[model samples]
Target: MHKFIVHGGRPLSGTIKPKGSKNEALQVMCATLLTEAIVTINNIPDITDVHSVMQLLTLLGVQIVPLGKGSYQFCAAHLHTDVTLTEIFRQEYAKVRGSIMLLAPLLVRFKSVSVPKPGGDRIGRRGVHAHFEGLERLGVTFCYNVDEEAWKAKCTTLSGSYILMPEPSVTGTANIVMAASMAKGKTIIYPAACEPHVQQLCHMLVAMGATITGIGSNILTIEGVAHLSGTVHTILPDMLEIGSFIGLAAATKSTLTITDVPINLFTPVWSCFRKLGIRLEEDDNSLHIPFQPSYHIQKEIDGNLLSLSDAVWPGIPADLISIAIITAVHAHGHILIHQKMFESRLFFVDHLIEMGARLILCDPHRVHVVGLGNAYRLRGTRMSSNDIRAGITLLIAALAAEGTSTIANIHQIDRGYEQIDQRLNALGASIERA
Candidate 1:
């Protein structure tokens, strides 16, 4: 257990690079299990959740070698197909929700596998029905064991079929595509998540000899291949991290240059921030957030309160809603933040209110924020980090507050962001992890 002692009132200014996409890295790492050849992955984020997934893969007998910074070589040539729900596997795999994705590749290669119920940030109820439903469409059968308290899936061979997902689930879509890569016949998935990470996974599978179409759309068609050959893939920059940084820069009135950002993927994020009257400059390979006194939250054309909410892909990312809420406190006008996906995500607004920012939690899914603007400064205080997104948001708010603040449960932040305390400290912020 670690806590961050952050001395507020210091503005962060420097060039900092975003780490590899954590969401993309997890799916890409699991893709290694679909092949016998060596799979080399670049720009892998060194975060806790990703490391947990790597440990899970190692337990499944996949050989993984660390080839220096942000690079890994994985080979499932001598993979062990059998997975018993041992205490060790349960303890490790339950720390990362991405561990559930292992079932897809394992079932495709070995026909049967056991997996514990996935565990991760308790932001909301994240059901796995979409994953099981998609798998069943591919000729897979799964059952839960009462005594073992684990899921058991069995299949002799998967014959692809059309799967219309109940929702556009990101991880669920990735799981189905991975399992369908080697299944017989063709698999068509409708209403699939078109998130950037999901698209990245599809591209990687295509490179490994799988035939896939509809790269960036809700409809995906995959023609099963006999087998896949390993290929090298590079992860894009972490967009969530980039959004957090942008919020931090705006909240603290700091000038920051974020290098190597994937600007091509910023249309949705940029549009959302623009609604808050926040502007950023983009270069060929970097994003520049200049120091400004404050931004005025823009109202609707009819002068109604601006509402920012999250939806499926191309929507304001659910992960960034927390940061946006914190950023809203420092802006000039009021904004309504609706976190529709996670019911409990708005509960963290109480801590922001504790810091002297005016916020009303309308419900579990909606929050009404009244910006204090530059005329009033938030008074910092002790707070507990409830989840990954909220932890970083609290950290950003603390940096923009008036006094020192203590943030406990920083491990939540570490699960996604790599060396965040050290990296933020490098940007002239006084954050000590203890």
Candidate 2:
């Protein structure tokens, strides 16, 4: 029940490095269950969701040792086989959707595993059908218990085959790949998610002696191995955090230099933000955004209103849409923010409209923001964060407002960003966590 009290009207300028990807950490940590030897992971983000998944792994008998900051060693030499659907596990599983990933690795090792329905942000209907479908294609059988709301899957021997994912689901792909790693034959996965984090997970599996081809493409071919040994893997930097910082710098007139960023993975992001007139300079490993007088949204050639939307990989990530909308509020022109992936995500704009932002909520999935372009300033007020992305977006908006603001339920933001208040405060932004 913590809150963040922010003092507004200050520009943040400093160098900061994005933490390891939370999504990647979740997937890679689950992969540890696929091996009996020691696996060391580096650059893990110290965030709530990641910690929760680690806790779940520990409960399932994975030995974890802290190697230092952002590093840990895991050994699943002994597993607590009977605790999968225990009451304690069910409670922890409700905290993160990534908990479902443990099922594949556990099944690969134990031949049977049971799990409760997974839970995550109420962004949209995230169906687990893709997970069951892909795994079922590889010779796994599952049965659901309506009374207990649990699913039990068992397969004495997994024989890999071709699996075309119904969608490019990141977690689903990770789950099936982990299972396929221990299967008996060649597995081909088409329409696989090729995000950097997904690629990182695939690379980690390959390091552990799994044969995988098409590391960064929609199609992946995996040859099952008899056994996998432990290997060390480092996660990629969090691209969502980098996108948030870029939007924050643009809206607040700050100069932010983000070091250790993989600038090439953000090709689509740079193009989208450039359309909003927020120029960025990048080097081999870092990116710099200098201070600007005013931001302006670029228009189309035929004079149509510009729009920023989310797509699969290589598009503006859906998680960054909220930040883009907040940046658009301070830019000069008008732009339509279309959140086609999730309906509940764009509903958070009501809080921004309450703070004197000129926005039209066309529907649950679309918003039109009219920038004041420094002609007017938002008056800070109280707001509650609905989700992780929306929470950080509101924090950025409060930092650019004229007065002080209070953001309650900051735990949502804490789930993704590691020590966000402390990190932004290092850049001269005044944020007090209570």
Give the per-residue lDDT of model 2 (tens digit) for 187-241. 9998998888889989999999999999899899999999999999999899999
What is the C-alpha local distance difference test score of each model? 0.90, 0.91
Residue-by-residue lDDT tens digits, candidate 1, 2-62: 8999999899899999999999999999889999999999999999999899988898888
Clashing pairs in 1: none
TM-score of each: 0.98, 0.98
Give the poorly placed runs of model 1, Cα more than 4 Å off.
none
Model 2 CA RMSD to the hidden true structure, in angstroms = 1.1
Error of 2 at 74 (Å): 0.5
Error of 1 at 128 (Å): 0.3
Give per-residue lDDT, candidate 2, residue 40. Answer: 100
